[model samples]
Target chain A: MIIAVASGKGGTGKTTVAVNLARSLAGPVHLFDCDVEEPNANLFLHGAVERTDEVTLPVPAVDAAKCNGCNECGRLCQYHAIASFGSQALVFSELCHGCGGCMLVCPRGAITETPRRIGVLETARSGDITIVTGRIDVGVAFAPPLIRAVKGRIGSGVTAILDAPPGTSCPVIATVTGADAVILVTEPTPFGLHDLTLAVETVRELGVPFGVVVNRVGMGDGRVHAYCAKEGIPVLLDIPDDRRIAEAYSSGRLLVEALPEYRTLFTGLWQAVGELAAKKGRATEVAR
Target chain B: MKIACTTTGNGLQSPVDPRFGRAQRLIIVDTDTDAFTVVDNAAGAAAAQGAGIQAAEAVVRAGAVALISGHIGPKAFRALRASGVKMYTTDAPTVEEAVKRFKAGSLTEAKSADVNGHW
Candidate 1:
């Protein structure tokens, strides 16, 4: 079964809930930090990175020698990535979607698909827990592609947990989709509540079963609880505001490892998730 | 010289649209003859990404040597400037007023983009 931990707003404990849940769960479990823009779960696990592979996107490269500038490729490009002027075709790699339409439409065979390194997918292991992370190169604007690259490593029969990127944008959608269940981590603040509404709408539109995990419980008001109750959404767990947890997190220590008592909490949270997914009939034939 | 002014309506009476990428229409008018053509900018306005760059390309293709708008984003600014298309900004009440300002040399040319594109 695959479970995705997501949050609408940043710094809402998505990585905390995801890493802890993956570590606490019994049997072989894989954790994918799908927040390619910034993957931090590896910091908590401190596992030696076993393997890494460069992730690349196909971008159009223009060949000046092969060209008669028909302007067909430039006109056909929806992205305006290929601009031809006075027998010269300029290919802006950053804007190319790698759709390959430019290459196909080019009458002179001037456009060729080229691989551009966008990010790297790395694997690490801490005992039975395997962590997969996508680390995007600096200045890369798109994260959905790298997120997909990390999620492609999902092994069958192993409980795969994904810590998704924040917000209701494309990257979050890519991570949250195909999950047996989704756990939305949020704080109790007003900003959290507002963003949570957007996230809930996104998952609901995708027709996925999901629940909420309130973090830093004592930091804000009860409006989040009120909103969830009004919407009939389940509040699976709440991690209280504790300075010790913060200090441990800052120093790159897992909550379950630093505070032995919280191990039970994460394990119980996993149990709740299994039950929730099972009830929704999404947890199919996955022996836990 | 042809100048393109972002407009709210098809005619010169229409208000000058401040937004460069999301403008409704681009009225390309010849400064010498006052002959003009209106290009629908809805496609760029509705584009998912690179709206500013696409609009800049449209301006370039329209044979407009200059652009008049409220703001020019970095992407469009770079493209227009690269193509030697000078850009001017105005809060003129109508497209006609903006063109008049352009003819009077009262409109200030934008040296660089005022804002970054959202996408």
Candidate 2:
């Protein structure tokens, strides 16, 4: 069963829940850090890198020699990545979405795809817990392609926890698309509640079964809880605002490892997630 | 010499648009004939990305030798430079005023992009 941990607001404990849940689970679990822009789960896990693979996107490359500038490729390119007025087509490689529509529309067959390295995937093992981190190279604007690359490494028949990027944008959608269940982490603050509403809408629109995990509780008001109750959404678990957790997280330590007491909390959270997924019939066979 | 001015409306008296990539309309004025034509730029304004590149292409295709705008992004700057089109910045309120400033050499030619992309 695959579960994606996501939050609309940054620093809302999606990674904390994802990594801790992956570590606390009893059986073999894979944690895929789909936040390719910046993968920080590895920092907390400190797992040794087992393998590294480069990720590439197939961007179009034009051949000027084939010679008739019909401008069909230019018209077909929605991104304006390729434009031809009366001469050879000008290709803006960075702007290309790699849709291959231009290549298909080219009557002269002058356009071909070439791989452009965008990011790298690192597979690491921390004891029985396997962590796959997708790290995009600096200045890479798009993250969905790299996020898809990370999800492609999902281990079969094992519980996979995807630590999604923040916001309800394309990257978050890419991460939470096919999950058995999604854990929307949030704090109790006004900012958290506002973004959480958007995140809830996003998941609901995608038709994915999701539950909320309120982090840093005891600081903000109970509006989040009230909102969830009114919407009939389950509040899976709540992690209180403790300075100790913050200090441990700051020093690159997992919460469950730093305070073994929290292992029970994460494990219980996992169990609740399994039950939630099972109730939704998303993971009947794999919910444990 | 023909020059393109980013504007809010179709007429020469229309206010000059501050944005280059998402300008509402482009007014192409012929210095020799004192005649002009308007090109609607709604497509570039609505583009998700590469709006500047597309706008630049449109200006080039309209046979403009120079561009007058409040700001130019790096991508558009490079594109216009490659096409041998000179870019100048104008604080003039209207397209006709901007053309007058361009003819009087009161406007500064941009050596590099004045603003970052998506600004």
Best by DockQ: 2
On a 0 to 100 scale, what is the lDDT of residue B55 in model 1? 85
Chain A of model 1 scored by TM-score: 0.95
Q: For every candidate, how close is chain A to the native chain A in TM-score?
A: 0.95, 0.96
Candidate 1 chain B: worst 10 consecutive residues by lDDT?
B74-83
lDDT of each: 0.88, 0.90
Give the interface RMSD of each candidate: 3.0, 2.4
Task: Provide the DockQ value for model 1.
Answer: 0.25
Cα TM-score per model: 0.78, 0.88
Listed models, DockQ each: 0.25, 0.42
What value of lDDT does candidate 1 attain over all alpha carbons?
Answer: 0.88
Model 2 stretches astray by more than 4 angstroms? A282-288, B7-19, B22-24, B40-48, B68-74, B77-119
Clashing pairs in 2: none
Score candidate 2 by lDDT: 0.90
Q: Which pairs in model 1 have colliding backbones? A: none
